[model samples]
Target: MLKDIVDVLADPVDGTPLRCADDLSRLVSESGHSYDVARQGYVTLAGGRGLNHEGDSAEMVTARELFLSQGHFAPFVEAVTERVAEVIDKSHAPEPVVLEVGAGTGYYLSHTLDSIDGSRGVGMDISVPAAKLLAKAHPRVGAVVADAWEGLPLLDASVDALTVIFAPRNPAEFARVLRDDAEAVILLADQGHLDELREPLGILGVKSGKLERMMRQAEGYLELVGDAELLEFPIRLDRASIAAQVGMSPSARHVEAGVLRERLARLPEFMDVTARAQLVRMRKS
Candidate 1:
């Protein structure tokens, strides 16, 4: 699987090209760096300091898999795939390289790959637990464990399109890795999202001005392509689904296990919850 998008990967230390070596068990960089490919089929590309962020834990990844597998976020996935397809068509790349930062479980990435023929993807996440699933998420996907905040381990102008689904982003790094005609699709949770669960589960709500803050952060590196689209849908979630949703999010860390369980038990067996987010498209400035 790593072979699929090996051309887009680079040495995290020097930003040089990397090739498969040692019977495809490791990636060797042009500057003489070697990174072992995990037996699960993913590789870790960190600089000398290595990864400072542990990202999501095993339990959180498992909870995410459980929640997503139930198709609770189908609309979000579909919207991302549609936007990516539009970008690829505009670029007219015969064989495109798509990248997903903080790609958890490769759910959204795998969906996008399925929609585009002859396309490959590199799913990058700092979490090893998430990378393991990402490696086998799709036949054409190459999974990598890398920190986005430090810098993306990708060659300049190597990516055709990128996607970030409720994940961390580095606009500067994104601009460096994207071609002149490339674009990045981002989905962020908007205010009022999961409002019903916040009060009961004691989870934090989506803050206001999230998009404004992000636009400010991308000021010099990238610019918005067009108006952002708001997608709002309602889902009927049962108690189990509610718990999985909370467990997969950052709120899981703040709420204790006992208290979260108690709050979940008090909720009705099935309740309607709103799913809201803003889908933004941007390109290099």
Candidate 2:
């Protein structure tokens, strides 16, 4: 899978082109920098200092896989795949490359790749655990452990479409890597998402003005291609699904495990909760 996207990768230190080494187990840069491919099949593309923060832990990644596999976020995944298909159809690139930043477990990336023909993906996340799962999530995807805050380790204008779902975005770097007509499809969680669980679970709520702040940040480098579309749906979740949802989110980090369990025990067997997010399309300015 790494072989599919090897030509698009760049050296994290100096931005030199990269190639597979003699045996193809390592990636070597034009400037002679070497990065070993992990036995699990992913590569870490951080610079000399290495990553500052671990994006997600193995527990979190496992919880995410469990929660998503249940299809609780089917609407979100469908919207992402639909938008990517539209972007690819418009571009008409014979073999389009889709890069997903902060791609947790490669769920969305794999789904999009399945929907489009002749499409490959780069699943970039800072978490090594997440990268390990992403590496094997699909046959057409290449997983890389890299920070979203840092510039993406990709060649200039190399991507036909980029996707960021419930993750960080670097608009300037996205603009540089995306082709002229390519778009960055972002799915941002809005207020009222998980409102039913917030009070009982004692977790944080979505802050107001989050989307507006994101648009302001992307003003110069990326422009909003269209109005943001809100995708809201309700799901009947059991206690286990509720636990997995909380455990995979930032809320998991704030609350103590025992306390969360105690609270979850008091809830009904099934709950009707809203999953809300905004899908926005942006293009290079």
Candidate 3:
């Protein structure tokens, strides 16, 4: 899998091109930097100082995998995959490179890669646990652990398409890596998302004006390519899925497990919760 997208990877220290070593167990950059491929098949492309922060914990990643595998968010995944297909179809690159920032567990990235013929993916996340899962998520995906805030450790103008779903995004870095025809597809949770679980589970709600703030932030690096699409769907979730949803989110870090369990126990057997998000497609200006 790493071999598939090795051409698009770069050394975090100096941005040199990377290639598989003699034995394929390690990657050596043009600058002579070597990063060992983990037994699970992913590589950590952080700077020499190493990762400053862990994005998601093992429990969180596990929760995410469990929750996502249940297909409650199938519509969201379908929308992302469909858009990625459109982007790839529009691009003339024979073998396009798809990059996903803060790609958790590689769920969406792997799905997109499967839909696009001759397409490879780079799944970038700061969490090692997430990277481990990402490495094996698809046959054509290469997983790397790197901070999205610092900058994407990718070659300039090397990416054909980028996707960000419920994760951190750096527009400047995106602009640097995406080709002229490439677009960055972002999915942001909107206000009233998961409203039914907010009061009952004591979880935080999506903030207002998030999309407007994001557009303002992307002003210099990226411009709107099309009208943002509002994706709304209803998920009938059980208590376990509700727990997994909470466990995989930021609220999981603040709430005590026992308290969260007690709150989830009081909920009904099934809930029709609203999952709402906006898909904004942007391109380098």
- Clashes per prediction? 0, 0, 0
lDDT of 1 by residue, 156-259 (tens): 99999999999998999999999999999999999999998988788999999999999999999999999999999999998888888988999998889898
Comparing 1 with 3 on TM-score, the higher-scoring candidate is 1
lDDT of 2: 0.94
What C-alpha lDDT do the candidate models reach, one value each?
A: 0.95, 0.94, 0.91
For model 3, state the Cα shift of residue 35 in Å: 1.2
> What tens-digit string does per-residue lDDT give for candidate 2 at 1-285?
899999899999999999999677899999999999999999999999899999889999999999999999999999999999999999999999999999999999999999999999999999999999999999999999999898899999999999999999999999999999999999999999889999988998988777899988998999998899999999989999999998899999898989988999999999999999999999999
User: In model 3, how large is the Cα lDDT of residue 84?
Assistant: 81
TM-scores of the candidates are 0.99, 0.99, 0.98
- lDDT-wise, the better of 1 and 3 is 1
Model 3 C-alpha lDDT per residue in residues 1-285, reported as the tens digit of each score: 888888888888999999999777999999899999999888888886888899999999999999999998888889988988898899879999999999999999988998899999999999999999998898888888889987788999999999999999899999999999999999999999999999988889999998899988888999998799999989899989999999999988677889988998999999999999999899998
- Candidate number with greatest lDDT: 1
Candidate 3 shows a clash count of: 0
Off by over 4 Å in 2: none
User: Lowest-lDDT window of 10 residues in candidate 2?
Assistant: 204-213
